[model samples]
Each structure stands twice: as structure tokens, then as C-alpha cells.
Target chain A: MNRTITVRPGLRDIPQGRLGMWLLIAGELVIFGAAVVSYLLMRIRYPEWGEQAQYTSTALGALNTFVLLTSSFFVVKAHKASLAKDSKNVVRFLSLTLLCGLIFLIVKGIEYSTEISHGFTLRSPGLVDSGQGVASLFWMYYYLMTGLHGLHVLAGMIAIFVVMLQVRKGKYFHRVELAGMYWHMVDLIWIFLFPLLYILK
Target chain B: MNIAHHEMSFWRRYIFSTDHKVIGFQYLITGLIMAAIGGYLAYVFRYNLAFPAESIPLFGSLGPKEYNAFITSHGAIMIFWVAMPLLLAALGNLLIPTMIGTDDMAFPTLNMLSYWFFFLSAIVLLLSFFVPSGPFDGGWTLYPPLSADAYINTEPDIWKSFMTGGTLIILALALEFVSMLMGGINFLVTTINKRAKGMTLLKMPIVVWFINFAVIDFMFSVGPIIAGAFMLLLDRVAGTGFFDAYRGGDPVLFQHMFWFFGHPEVYVLLFPSLGVIAEVISTFSRKALFGYKFIIKASLIAIVLSVVVWAHHQFIAGIDPRMATFFSIGTILISIPFAGIMLSYIATLWGGNIQLKVPMMWALGFIAIFLVGGLTGLYLGSDTFDIYVHDTSFVVAHFHYTLFPITFFGFFAAFYYWFPKFTGRMYNTVLAKIHFWFTFIFFQGFAFPIFFLGLDGQHRRINDYSAFDSLMSSWHISFRQFATISAIILILSQFIFLFNLLKSLRSGKKSEENPWKANTLEWQTTSPPPHGNFVKYPQVYRDPYDYGNPDMKEDYLPQNKVI
Candidate 1:
């Protein structure tokens, strides 16, 4: 009885909605690619502006990285549990993943507020090599990249919540696994972003 | 294959429809109406051009500011509102669905939203004309400094209208892009996963694959533009200094963003409708598209090339010389794929049972015009040549060749091909051909000399060119004469199309379910298709182009049936 009902098609079969998500993701990856490319070029042109890097707090970013990585573990467990017809564990592990997502967003909000109070506004001035002042390009990129990532976290949380509701209703159970994969991909992006923004000199 | 899950309603079926066919027609209708407004604006401005600040015989003598207003509004409406919408939104709507076997789009509600937003955009655009500052006069590009200060002394502060309208257009294009993306996924997934069982990727019709590629093209290309729109809107209202140079921003940045979308917007307008023309001629003539596989491979190559070549438009914008040369060469390289597709179409017509139908003739006309249009494109892309022709009548001439001929002519070709499927009745061959020739000859008159004038270094957008050497001045005078005559002829050509559509609804001969014997799944359904589309799901076995094969009894294979 347990073996008869699996939520998703075996590896060969891809649900329509899941494939749509992947296609949509490919488009998204290019957009992020561009903004990231712009950031890389701008950063390379100006090297000594590592002062902004000191304030970005590698410890918090590393902590958030661990939280996101750990959340993926719970999401994978939830997917496997859903396939095994263990709805109880599915609910438990998914809730944990969702909690981690909320924590990540909350921490990001705190970081943004702290940076603003420190007078690191997007258009704030910084000293160049000769004591000439220029608007902070690094900070502009900081707000653009991190701010966009923050929005993605909010979106991911919503997607996870929808998956929970769907699992409750016993509808589109196959979709949860795919959604989890996508959520992990979003988390994976931040993993790179964290090291680049916070960990790097 | 399970269409039971995909049924829709009457309001949802046609009017306010999400059906790509309906949406395509809606886009077509909206584009032509905009064209008429835009086209007339050009005529009014031409009179202003021939006799500066003088009242013309018709529509009253124009004022200087009105010329400024007319020139700005006309260029914006024609290029963005008419050309882009007609070719991409209208034609892409109709063809993407039919070429693939999908019953309807993936998200029907979203599809409807796309057209309505386009409608809102057109309204916003027209509304600006009536406002004080008398609509933006800073040309359609709407460069900063000229558009910067609020009317020191001008009617409706129309720059705000430009801002509001331009944003709506971007939103509409975004909506179009999203719905099309969903439709593309459906096409790709259905082609791969739900291909009526027997249809293989190679077996899919050439047109099916073209639209599939178009979906991917718009998806990747549109994002930068979407971000650009937001920034422009921010600059417009939010006091953001994104493009406001005096406010510590870069004006050229706006050009970078606009052209990023603007340049690929050409392919967005070109490829899908060309796909339709490709399908129409091959099927009607009882032949497979020549080099079908290479055309497919070449188009994908084209999509990749389009993304990188956008900087070609900015060669003169003071970029690094090294980067400029690289982009210029890339822009020229992009033409290679276009050459491949054109050669394939011409070869498809070879050694076939050529149908001399109105649609076939229009398709041939498209080939001729597009060839010239495309080949001359080489000039605009080369850095050395571009320096001479940039912003001149020659560049304008080159585009009008490609755009009007393909977009209008190719769309008409599609109209005659599928008007039966859409309306369940045949169009009058006499009227369609009549409309075709008048517009075709007039199009020649309109575009051909404008090329020569461009060679003469005749600049565009001037209110008067009467003082130049007569040889150079002749280009403007001749331009004035031929352009106005062609404009009126093209505008009148629409009536024949409209009359045929309206009359054919009740009066024309009823068509069989699949009159053209097309291989695609749209033909598997009834003439207009049913509410759920089909009672029995179609299973595919043979390719969409099984025509003239000795192994097959019928000339064409239904995409659903086994060989």
C-alpha cells in the first residue's frame, strides 16, 4: 500500500509545472548573470575600496550560509519522506526548512539597518587614492545585489508556504520536490553571494 | 495530450481571448490602428518638411512645435507601438500556438492581461498628444537635456506622458514576454513530452521549432530591459539619478538600456512571423521547408548572437575603440544566421508544386524585400560604413525595407493562410491580391529611393531640406512625393483586408476542417477548433514534412497519425 502511491513520477517523468519552473529559472539565471557581471567589472576597476568589505561582517554572512545549507538538508529530507508516504516527517522537516528561511531574512534585515545607520548609504561618498571623493560604487552594488537577494528569500518563503498548503490538501504533491530543488538553487546562489560579498577582501 | 484539463469558454474563446490566434489578431489589429495614426503623423510632418512651418493643403499648416511634437510621437508610435507589436505580439500570438499542437496557451488569464496592458499602453501614448507641452518633442529616443526641463514655455507637459506611456509599453511587453514564455514552455514541453506520441524533434515542422526558439530569445533578452524600465520610471518620478546626468547620473546609460532591448527587439519582431511565412509557403506548395534542420540550428545560433550584438547600436557612443570594433563585427556576424534562413526559404520554393496563391506571392515578396533589407543591414553593422550612414535616411530606408515588408507583408501572408482556420471561411482571392499588389508596388516606391537618399547624405527629421544642392534636395522632394503617396496607398490597403475579413465571416465559401492539408496539430482540430479542441487525442508517428516522399500515399502527414 505504501509503495503504490508516490507523489512524483520516477526520475524519467517530469511534471509540467516543475519543468516550467526550471525554464523560468534559466531566464532568471541570465538576469542575475548580468547584474553580477556589472558588479564584477565595476569592482575590478576599483580595488582599494575594500573598506566596505570590512563592514559587511563575514561572521553573519557565514552564519547565514550555514543556515541556508542546513535548511536544504531538511528540505531534501522532506522530499524523501513525502515519497516514502511519511507525511508526518514531511510536515516536520518542511516546517524546519521554512523556519530557517525566515531566520535568514530576519538576519538580512538587521544587517541592512546596521549598514544604513553606519552612513553607508547607496550614494554615500568615499575617499579615492588621492583623497578625492566619489560616490560609492561598491555600496551601490551592495544594495542592488543583497537587496535583490533579500527579495528572493521572501519569494522562496512564499513558495515553501504554498508547497506546505498543497501538501496539506494532498494536491500536486509531486511539485513539492521540484519546488524544494528550486528553493535549494536560490539558497545555493546566496552561498556564492555570501562569500563574494562578505567573506572576500 | 489530455485536453480534457484544458477546455475554455466563449469570452475566453475569442473576444477577450487568451487563444494565441485571437491574441495575435488583436495585436495585429492594435498595431495597424497605431500604424494609421503613426503613418498619418508622418504625412503631416512630411508636409512640414517640404514647406517648413507652412500650412499644408490638408490637416492645416503645421507649427514648428507641432512638427517637433509630430516627429517625436510619430517615430515612437511607428517603431515601438506599430512595428514591434504587430510583428511580435500580434503575429507571435497566432503562430506560436498553431505551429505547436497545444490546445491553448499555458496561462490563459495572463495572456489576456498581456493584450489589455498593450491596450492601456496605446491609450497612454495617445493621451500624451493631448496634454500640455503638446506631447514630447525630444524625438522618440527622448534624450535627457532636451526632455530634462519641464516646458519652459510649451502645451501639455508631454514628457510626463512619454514617461507614463513608455512604462506602460514596457509593462505590456513584459506581460507579452511572460505569457509567451509560458506558451514557449508549453510548446517545448509538448514537442518533447506530449508530441502526439509519434512526433519526434526532427519530425516537428520547421515553424514549430522557430517559435520555440523565439520563446527562449525573448525570455533571456527581456530582463535587462525590464530593469531598464524600472530605472527610467524611477528617474521620471522618484528623483532617482539613474539617468539624470546633472543629478550625478549618466544620460548615455539610458541609451545603453534602451538599445539593449531595442536591438533584440528587431529579432523579436522578425523571427516568429518569418516562421509563419516559412510554414505557409512550404505547406501550400506541397513541399518541405528546404534545409529544415539547418534552419533550426541556424536560428538557435541567431538567438545566442542577438544577446551579445546589442552594443553594435552604441558604436558611436564613445565606447572603447576595441569594444566598438568587436561589437561591430559581432553585429555583422549576426547577419549570417539570417542569410541561412533566407537561403533555406528560397530553396524551399525550388522544384516544388508552386501554388501561385495570394499567400505564396506575399511570401515571395517577403523573401525579395527581406533579402535586400537584410543584406543592406551589413552596411549598418560595419563600423566604417556605419559612420557614414548612421542616423541618415539610408539607415531608415534599410529598416523600413525589412520591417514593413516582412511585418506587414508576412502578416498578410499569414492572414490569407489561416484566415480560413480563424474565421471558418475563405477570403476573396481577388481582393487579397488586389491589396497585395497595390501595397507591394507602393512599398517599393517608399523604401527603394530612401536608400539612395541615404547614400546622398540626406539627413532625417529636418523640417526643410529645400536649400541643399538640387541633387541632394531632390532626394527630399522625391522622398516627400513617394512617401506620402505610398502612405496613403498602404493605409487604404487595410480596408480591403478588413472588408474581406468582415465579408468572409458570412459570405465566403466554407472551408474544410483542414483545407491546406497542413501537418501541424491545429489542423487536427476543426476549422475554428472546438471548445476542448478534439474528441480523440492525436498520436504522432511521421514528421510534419512528409510531403512528396515516395513512402507516403498522401502528400502531407497529420502530426498525430502514424505513417
Candidate 2:
């Protein structure tokens, strides 16, 4: 890629698209940071929230973490393939990454259904009725944090699928790295979500 | 400059155009229209407050609910819909590329999308007023308990909740924040990546630097509030307990989250207005900006201090005393940096060929009026003093003094400053000056009396003062009547500005390329620059404010001139 050096010397070495992506990542991180910080503050106030953590299915959380980690590796490989101008390998690794996103979402869907069927929904009826009203807040935060993460996974899958299609047509290879970077952010957020929600108990 | 261009249809060129200037104009007009709506809302509420149940001329009698909704919408619309769109989005889109000597924004399509998103959010907010329930009446801050109590005792249904005013307003705000985030990214990237050959960072205009800081401040501060808004919406719709104290949630947590974004949000508005004042002061004074670098550094320090002073707004909202003390000190400390910046502006005006143009008049009005607002703020910033005067009309007067000048005064200064470039025609200076004086005098007449009334222990957000016999003294009644009359005249005076704008667009004299003979890169281009902006791309040599240089033949030097 040909790069035109602008008068600002410091950022000229960074591609404009990559720089834009990094700034966007910074914004998204702060957003998630708010949720994380709020949760940690509330968790300290109510240690019994760890009791609600027992219901989060640690085994499934671990499996999804592995799946997301593998997807991150696949996206990095796709970035490498795009650097080499190998569109075929780029498509291959991107599709693998998309597949992992799909598996992670499926696992999350199953866990959500199991929790709901077991009367552990966002507005859990049993907790509210038992006069431990604050405990229901734990379930609310649990669903909110994981549910927001699940939406990101779905968005990442769509993004990866689009990039894969464009790569298949031998166009816009640089978007592969942008898509990879976004996927890493998604993966990184889940890494935080996992220990906080599932393993803390 | 030699690039060939093709003609496009009207829809592509104006409505869906990716050009920054056209998009800027779109935001400008939209914001002005929203300002009209907000102003009308203010008139209705002010009329009710003064007359106490007397029917208004244009609108009928105002009820308590209607009065609450009007004040709430007026505050929300002015800040979110008017000030932000006009100052940050409109001015940022217009000036960043032009002043930096670039053809367009780095991401033009995203820039276009940002305006459309803002347009959509404006529509949503307007539609919110006509919902079954009136618009959100829990104040512009959207404090919980009041905001979250929409359907407290009933079973929550998604569709039912969606139609309510509170939920719709939150949705509108979320959309607005998304739009601004997109616009912020575009501003940051464009200013960083696209500049002329010799236009280094320091050589860029102060307005561009201030816009960048405002955008950065916005991006960092708005996140927690976005998260908080989501939680508040869930509390309304999904039977969730994110901010309901009765349902295991703490409302104070919402206050912390809201003010976390709210206080910096003031700077997000102030910084750009200050930037406009800097440009206007330097130009009209025919002097180089005094302490230009110092002003920028001081504003940076002020931005940092702004983030830590959010809790000052919450001293009487049940925060810890120690935390309030820390916040009070922080809030008082913040005034120093701002004072330094203001002093620099005054210093820039010291001993030079000062021209009292319409724009310069507005700029001077801003510094004088905003000082009153800023100094009054220190009293409220202290925890001890705030406990007595919290939620009084004094706070109301303080903010209106600050915000009215920042938004409207700053806007008129910018609008008149760039009118020629915007339309390629000179405005009627006599009518413009008349408009400015009417606005300035009446604004002070309207907002200044409230300080005395608030000192007399008159509370805000009360529709009818008849219920409180103590608040309805002859002295209080006269002040209300005087302020309301002044506000009415203040709202009506805007028509003169509109008339001036219309007259200029139709039959005014053609403006020269550099009417002011100033030294910004934007003036180096034609009045109403062409599609590619410049016949030849400019190469900058010096800083934006090089007025009255000793070695120069002319009093001012343009940035692009190769001296």
C-alpha cells in the first residue's frame, strides 16, 4: 500500500484506517469499562452475588473462552494471509473465525435457556419473592453483561462474514486486519466477562 | 487542483452529498430549527411562571404536567439538539477540512451518516413530545427514581414501554450519542490525517484544536452515561432494577454515572465557544492572539479538571461530605484554568486596531456575560453554600447565563463571522447590529433578575407560585413579570436575525474572497469555496494568528502566504 506522509509526523507511520480502528477500539473499551467498574463496585457491596455465580455454568464458560481464543488466533492468521496477498487463505481463516463465533453464540444461547428454564432469568421470580430483592440485581447484571457480549459476538460474525466475501472477490484486503482487530476486542471483552461472571465464585 | 469533476443530480449533491460543507450546512439549519422549538418551549413555560395559570397568546393555558414537560424538553433540546449540533457538529464539519487545507473529511461517508443519524434523533425527540404521555419531565439530567418510575406498579410490556415518553427520550438520546461518537471519530481522524503540506499541528487554527479537544472530551466522558442510559431504559421497560431503590438498586449510582458525563459535557460545549471567541478576538482586534500556546495548555488543564469536578453537582444529592469537600475544591480549582484562557482573550484585545463588528460585539458579550455565570458557579460549587441554594432559581440563572452565551452568543459570533463565506454575500450590518444589541440587552434583563429572586428563596420547577404565599411577594412577582417580558422580547428579536439572513441571501452585495483580510487558511480560499474547495491546494507557512507582524508589509498575514 502506498502511504502519503502528512505534516503530522508522529501518526504518519500508522495507516489511517488502522489508526481510526484503534481510536474506535479505545472508545468501545471505555464503554465496557463502565459496565465492568459498576459491576465490581456493586459486587463488593453484595458479596452474595458470588452465590448467584454458581448458576452461571463454569464448564460452558470455559469452553466458550477456548472457542473465542481459537477464533482470535484464526483472525490473526487471516491478517497474516492478507499481508501476504493470499486471498484464499484469508477466506479460509476468516470463515474459521466466523465458525467459532457461531459456536460461542450457540453455547451462550444454551446457557441462557438453561438459566431461564431454571428460574434464573434477568427478573428472577424466586429471588424477588424471597425478600432477597438485591439478589435479583445479580441476575440482572449477569444477563446484561453476557447478553451485551453475545450481541457483540453476533456483530463480529457478521463483520467477519462480510470481509470474507470481499476477500473472496480479491478486493479490500486491508479490511481483513480491521475486522481482525475488532474480533480481538470482542475476544478481549469476553476474557474479562468470563472471570468476573463465571469463575469468581 | 487539476482533478476533473462531473455534475451530479440535486439529491446526490445536497441531500446525500458526502461533501463536508454541505453536511455542515445541513447540521446548521437543523440545529437552528431545533433551537426555535426549544425557544418556543421556553416561552410557554416562562409565560406560565410569570402569569400563573393565565392563558398564553399562542398556546393555551399550561397545566403542571405541561409546564414540567416544556421545561424539561427546553433544557434537553437546547443542550443536546441545538448547542451540540451547531457548535461541535456543524462548526467542526465546516472548519476542520477547510482550515486544515484539505478537500474533505477522511471518512466522508461516515460524516454524512453522522448528520443523518442526528437528523433522525431530532425527529425521534420531537415525536417524543406527542406520545400518549408528554415528553420526559424528570429534568434533562434524567435522574432516576423520577425517570425510572414510568410503569412502576404495572406489569412491564416492551411495546407499552416503547410508546412512553421516557423510553422514547432515552432512545433518542442513545441515537444522538451514537451519532456524536461517529462524528467524533471522523473529526479526530480527519484533523490527524489530512492537512496541507506545511500545516503542522501548532500552525492549525485554535478552533480546530479546540474542536479536537471537545471531541476527545466527549468520547471519553459519554461512555458511562451511555451505559447508564441503557440501565435506566431497562428499569422502565423490562422490570429491571438498575436504578430503583425500592427494587434493590441505588439511585445515587445513577447520579454518579450521569454527572460523570454531564460536567465534562459542559466543557464539551464551552471549549468550542471559547475557541470561537479566540478567533473573533484575534481577528477583530487586528492583533496576534496573546498567549496562544498558554491558552491551549490552560484549556487542556481545564479539560482534565472538568472530569474530576462532576460530584460538585451532587453535593446536596446525598454524597459523602468528604467526597463533596474533595469535589468542591476540585470544582473551585477548575476556574483558574478557564480564567487564564479568558484573560488571554482579554489580553489579545489589548491595544490594537479593534473593529467593533457584529461578530466581535457578540464575542465581547460572551466574555462579559460568561464571567458572571462562572463567578456565580463558584458559590454553588462549594458544598456549604450549595446546600442552602440547591435547586433554586439562582442555579437556573447561573446556567442560563453560562449556556445562553456559550450557545447563542457563540453561535451568532460564528454565524456572522462566517456569513460571507457561507453565502457569498454580505449581511446588512445595521440590522445585524440591531439584532445583537436587542439580544444582548434582553438576555441580561431576563436572566439577571433571577439571581435576586433565587436569593429570596424562590425555588425552580414550580409552575404556579400562588401556592407558596411567601414566594409571591410583590417584589418576587415584579421580577418574574420583568424577566418574562424580557424573555418574550428576547425570543422575538431572533426574527430580525432571520430577516437579515434572508435579505442577505437574496439581494446583498457580493463579498470578497477575504473580506476580513484575516490569516486563517479558510480565508485563503474563495468565498463559498467550490466543490473541490480550492482552485489550488494551499501550503501553509505560519500560524493562524499572525496579525500585525512587525516585518510584514500588511497588518495581517494569511497562513498560506510565502513571506
TM-score leader: 2
Error of 1 at A70 (Å): 3.6
Per-residue alpha-carbon lDDT of model 1 for A1-201, expressed as tens digits? 467665866432666566767876776676566566555654675565466688898878888999999999999998998897676777788899999998998888888889888766554433222232223456656777787777877787788888887787766667678779778878867877887788778
Worst 10-residue lDDT window for candidate 1 chain B reads B149-158
Q: How displaced is residue B95 in candidate 2, in Å?
A: 0.4
lDDT (C-alpha, whole model) for all candidates: 0.70, 0.90
lDDT of 2 by residue, A1-201 (tens): 999876865864577788788888888888888988999999999998888899889999999999999999999999999999899999999999988998998999999999998888877878888887788899889988888888888888898899899999999999999989999999999999999999999
lDDT per residue for candidate 2 within B168-214, as digits (tens), equals: 88998989998999999999998888888888888988999999999
List the DockQ of the predictions in order.
Answer: 0.23, 0.68
Q: Candidate 1 on B204-317: residue-level lDDT in tens?
A: 766656666766677777666555554554344433344544333456655665677677777876776688788887987788878888888888888888888887777777
The clash numbers for all candidates, in the given order, read 11, 0
Most lDDT-accurate candidate:
2
Give the TM-score of chain A, superposed on the true chain A, for all candidates in the order listed.
0.86, 0.94
Error of 2 at B193 (Å): 0.8
Q: Model 2, residue B206: what's the lDDT?
A: 94
